[model samples]
Target: MTWTIRPPRAEDHDMLAEIYLSVRRQTFVWVDPGKFHHEDFAAHTNGETILVCEHADGRLAGFLSLWPEDDFIHMLYIRPEFQGLGAGTALLQALPEWPQHKYRLKCLVNNRRAKAFYLSHGFVVTGNGASPEGDYEELSFCPV
Candidate 1:
């Protein structure tokens, strides 16, 4: 599928929120789904730079948000149906200075898929820590 990456507009928030809530509920089965809320998207990504991926048909496929100051990717969530279709990589590549600068993110230890995805894309585990949700590995992709 073809996808275009663009900065989000106010009108995109509702769908983005839904995508965030649903993907978290689906991916983080250990967490109580009730704890995930639509508003969490806004709260978590506030002040971050976000890039939304839209499919050729106009549906929003996924989004990636990052703290530009630290080159930290805060969140990268794609709708369940859209996973593995290149949206994640596209979003990552769309980031500012991608492949030419170091970028970092944390992935829950239990999320094998996400960890593998990042690793396959050249992210290496740089550190480890615990979050309210679970243990996580800090991963970074450093340009060679």
Candidate 2:
């Protein structure tokens, strides 16, 4: 259950991609997993700051990508089996000098688990809108 958070390396690309794809598939069941590939993940994550959570045995547990320049959190995903083990909270706390600042992210309105997690972690709903995939609620987390 212990995990280490570190910046992802090029060699970890495939494993990270799989973790990302798997979490998306499990959490967002409405998505077509066939439509995604490692290359697509690479393209979408290019230039972003990506952090990977690795278990004591070095297995990939989860990852979080941040666009610091825009003060936005692009993605945060924990493997289905790794949920509720403090990995997600650890990832958020691992960010460099981030907790004291405000950042924004969007979560699908149908994703009640994620919405509740964010709310419990201090993020407040700032607005709501619709996306091609589904309706989404925008949230902002500001440090107290």
Candidate 3:
């Protein structure tokens, strides 16, 4: 199925929040799922640029949020059902300066699948650090 990336509207907030909460609960098994709430989405993404990926049929498939000033991808979460369907790639490619600008993101060290995905997309490990979420690797990507 095809997907389209677009800026999210106010009406999309609740669904996006649910997507964020659900994906996190499913992916971050190390974390206490009870601590994640739908409201966390708005709090975490406040002031960041967010792009939503919508399945051709109009369902919200996933979303990516970034700090434009730092070219930092703070979060990229695709619904479990949409994980391998190209929604993440569509969101990244839709960035305003994608392919030309270097974008960075932190991938939890334990999330091998996500690290592999970013690496396959041209991101390289630049550094490592620890976060409350656990150890993470800083990865950056720029097509060249």
Candidate 4:
């Protein structure tokens, strides 16, 4: 399916919130949906740059939430259904234009599938980080 990946607009908060909620409902989703109340979604959107993937009909098929690091992909996600359709790669391809070096992100050890996806994308395990919940191993990726 054809798609357009674009920076999220102010009006996209409701849609973005839906994506966030969907991920939280996923079996591997470690994030708590309660923390992303609609009232604060816009604020979170500001802290984490949002990119929405729009299908040919203009529906938001997925999104990538990037946390900049020295200007790189700190974190990201695509709707589970659209995971293998190049949406993640499209988001990664758009990051370097701002002039960044290495990108780093953490994944819950239980999310084996996601970890594999990162590995396939050229990210390597570098170290580990921990939240109150548990350990989140960090994976680093350099633009190829």
The numbered model that scores best in lDDT is: 1
Report every candidate's CA lDDT: 0.95, 0.86, 0.93, 0.69
Give the backbone clash total of model 4: 0
lDDT per residue, candidate 4, 1-144, as tens digits? 577889887777687777766654573456664554555455655677767787777777767777764443544657777778887777766665622457777877777877888899788998987864357788887656
Candidate 3 lDDT, 1-117, residue by residue in tens:
799899999999999999999988988899889989989999999999999999999999999999999999999999988898899999888988788889999999989999999
lDDT of 1: 0.95
| lDDT at residue 94 of model 3 (Cα atoms) | 96
**Candidate 2 Cα lDDT to native:** 0.86
For model 4 the TM-score comes to 0.78
RMSD in Å for model 1: 0.6
Name the lDDT of candidate 4: 0.69
Error of 3 at 20 (Å): 0.5
Per-residue accuracy of model 2 over 42-91 as CA lDDT, tens digit each:
87788999999998988888899999898788889888888989899989
**Could you tell me which 10 consecutive residues in candidate 4 have the lowest summed lDDT?**
33-42
Listed per candidate, the RMSD to the true structure in angstroms reads: 0.6, 1.4, 0.9, 3.0
Alpha-carbon error at 13 in model 1, in Å? 0.5
**Model 2 clash tally?**
0
Determine which window of 10 residues in candidate 2 has minimal summed lDDT.
32-41
